[model samples]
Target: MMRRLYQSLMAASRAHAQWEIETTTNIIKNRKMLIILLLMALPLIIPAMVHAASLPEAIGGKAAYGPSYFSAKMFYGSIAIGVVAGLVTGCIGAGGGFLITPALMSLGVKGILSVGTDMFHIFAKAIMGTTLHKKMGNVNVGLAVAFLVGSGLGVTGGGIINRALYNYNPVMSDFTISMIYAVLLGFLGFFALSDYFKVRKSELSKNKIGLEKLTPMAERMQSVNLAPMIQFDEKIVPGGRKISGVFVAISGAITGLLAAILGVGGGFVTFPMFVYGLGISTYTTVGTDILQIIFTAGYGAIAQYALYGYIFYTLAMGCLLGSLLGVQIGAITTKVVSQSKIKAFYAIAILAGFINRIFALPEKLSQMGYISLTPSTGAILTNIGVWVFFGLVAIFAVWIIGTFIVNVPNLRAEYDEGSKAEYNAEYGEDNKAVVSTKRGAAQ
Candidate 1:
C-alpha cells in the first residue's frame, strides 16, 4: 500500500514538474503579461527593496526580521530555498512542497506566515502556468466540479482554524504547525526509507518492475453502488468505473484542508485519492489533480492567507523564480540517473525534512512552557536539526549539479540527435531537399 502510494505521489510530482515548465515558458513568452504582473507587484517590490536591510529580530543572526519584514537576504534566501525544493521535486519526483513550510519555520518565519506565503506561491505559479484547454480531454467534468464544491468548504474551515489559532496565541500557532509537520514527516520519512531498502533488496535478487494490484480499500470503494455515481475512465477501462460523488467530495475536502494548512496545494494527496482511494485511472487522475491544485491553492492563498496578512509577496516571487530554473535542471538530471538511486535520494530528502521539523519542536514547546528545557538546549537541538536538514539538502543539490555538469556533453548529443530525428520524421524528403539546397547555396 505504501509502495503504491509512493508511485502515485511520484506520478503527481512529474505532472507538477511538467506544469511548472510549461507555465514558466508561457509567462516568459508573453511580455505584456509579465509586465502586467510586475506592475501589480510594484507596491510590494518597491517597499521590499527600500527596506532591504537585515533586522536583528526579524532576520535572526546579525539580522532581525518579522512577518512583514522583507530584506534583500530574506528574498534571496527564499529563492535559494525554492531552488532546493524544486530540485527535490524534480529529481525525486515528489515531496518538494513538503520542504517549504519546514524550511521557512527553520528560518524563524512564523508558522502561519510560512504556510500562507507558500500557499500564495503555489497559487501564483498555478494561475500563471496552467493551460487548461490542453488538459481538458483527460478531465472528468463531473468529478472536478464535485471535488471543488467540497474543496471550497474545506479550505474555508482550514483557514478559519489557522487564523483562530494564530489570533489566540502566535506561539500556539507555531507549535501546532510544528507538531503537525513532525508527525507527518516522520511517518512519510520512515515509510520511504523502508521502501528504499526493500527495493534495493529486490533489485539484488533480480526481481523488479512488478505489477501493482489495486488496494483492497479501492476495490471495496468501487464495489459499493452509492448514489450520484460519477462515471469515468471511458477512454482507458472497458466501460468505466462509478463511485459516489460523496466519496470524491470527502477526498477533496481532506486535500483542501491540508492545502490551506500546509500550503502544498493538494497535488500530493489528490493523485492518490483519485487513483487508489476512488479507483480512477491514472489518465483521468492527472488532469483532475491539476484542476484541483489550481482551485485549492488559489482559494486558500487568497481567501485564507493573503487576506489575513500572512503572505509575503517577496518570498513568493523569489521561490517562484528559483523553482522554475531548479525544476528544469532536476527534471533533466533524471535522464542521467538510475531509478533506484533516485528513490533512495527521495527517501533521504524526506527524512531530512522530517528530522528538521521534529528537532525544532523542542524549542517551540520550551518557549510555550510546555517543556521544561533550557532555551540554550532547545536552540542547540533546533540548530542541529537545521544543519542536518540543510546539509543533506545542500549535498543533494551539489551532487545533482555536479552530475549534470559532467553529463552535459552526453545530454546535448542526445538532444541534438533526437531533434534531428524528429525534424526528419516530420518533414521527410522535402525538408532534406531544402536543407541540401541551402547547403549547396552556402557552398
Candidate 2:
C-alpha cells in the first residue's frame, strides 16, 4: 500500500512537471506577452532595487525588508538555488519547488520572506506558462473553477494564520514554519526512500517495468455520488468520473493552505490528492493543477505576503532567471539517464531536505524557549545542517551537468535524427530536397 502511494505521488509529480515545461515554453514563444509581463514587472522590481538598501526596518511594527534586501552574494546565491531547483524539476519531473523554502531558510533568510518570495516566483512562472495549456485544450473549465473556489478561501485563511503568528513573535513564526517543513519533508522522504529501495530490490530480480494500480481510497472516493457531481474529462476517460463537489473543494483547500504556508506551488501535493484521493485522471489533474497554481500563488503572494511587505522582488527575479536555464539543461540531460537513477536521486534530494529542516528545528525551538540549549551548540548544529543541505544539492547539480556535457554529442545526434524524421513526415520525401534548399537560402 505504501509503495503504491509512493508511485502515485511520483506519477502526479511528473504530470505537474510536464505542465510546467509546457507553460514556460508557451510564454517564451509569445514575444508580445513576454514584453508586457516584463513591463508590468519593472514598476515593482525597479523601485524595490533602488530602495532595498535603505527601506524602513519595519512595517506595522513588524520587522520587514525591501526588495534590495539581498547583497551581491545573496542575489547570486538565489540564482544558484533556482538553477538547482529547475534542474531537479526538469530531470526528475517533480520535487524542484520543494527545495526553494528550505534552501532560502538555510541561507539565513527570514521565514516569511522565504515564503513570500517563493510564492512570487511561482506566480510569475504560472503567468508565463498557463496560456499554452489553455490553448492546447487540456483544461476542464468546471473542474478548475470548483478547485479554485476552495483554494481561494484556503489560501486566504492560511495567509492570515502565517501573518498573525509572525506579528505575535518572529520566533514563533520561524518555529512554526520550520516544524511544518520538518514534518512534511520527513514524511515524504521516508516513503520516497522506501520506494527507491523497493525498486532497487525488484530490479535486481524481475528486471521489468511495473504498472501502478489505483489505491482503494481512490476507488471509494470515485464511487461516492454526492449531489452536484462534477462531470469532467469525458474526452479522456469514457463516461468520465464524478464525485461530490465538496471533496474537490476540500482537496483544494488543503493544497491552498499548504501553498500559502510553505511558499510552494502546491502541485506536488495537488497531483497526489487529485489522483489518489479524488481518482482524477492524470491528464485532467495536470491541466487543472496548472490552472489553479496561477490563482492560488498569485493571491497568496500579493494579498498574503506582498501586502504584508514580506516579498523580496530581487530574489524572486534572480530565481526566475536561473530556473529557466536550469530547467532546459535538466530536461536535456533526462534523455541520457535511466529512470531508476532518476528516482534514486529524487529520493536522496528529498531526504537531504528533510534532514536539513529537522536539524534546523532544534535552534528554532531553543530560541522560542521551548527547549534549552547552549548558544554554541545551537550555532554548531545549524551550521552542520546548512552545510549538509547545500553539500547534497551541490553534488546533485554537478552530477546532472557533468552527465549532460558527456552525452552532448549523442543528444545532438538524436535531436538531428528526430528533426529530420519529423520534417520528412511533414513535407514528404519529394519535397525534402526543395525544403533543404529553401531552408539554406533563408539562413
Clashes of each: 12, 1
Q: Tell me the tens digit of each residue's lDDT in model 1 across 335-441.
A: 99887887778778888988998888888788778879998998899899999998998888889878989999999999999999999888899978999999999
TM-score of each: 0.87, 0.85
> Per-residue error at 260 for model 1, in Å?
0.7
| TM-score, predicted candidate 2 vs. hidden true structure | 0.85
Worst 10 residues of 1 by lDDT: 203-212
Whole-model lDDT for model 2 versus the true structure? 0.78
Q: Which candidate achieves the best TM-score against the true structure?
A: 1
lDDT tens digits, residue span 301-385, model 2: 9999998788877788778867876788889898999877877887788888888888887877787788999877987888888
CA error at residue 376 for candidate 2, angstroms: 2.0
Which stretches of candidate 1 lie above 4 Å from their native place? 1-3, 25-66, 201-214, 223-225, 432-443
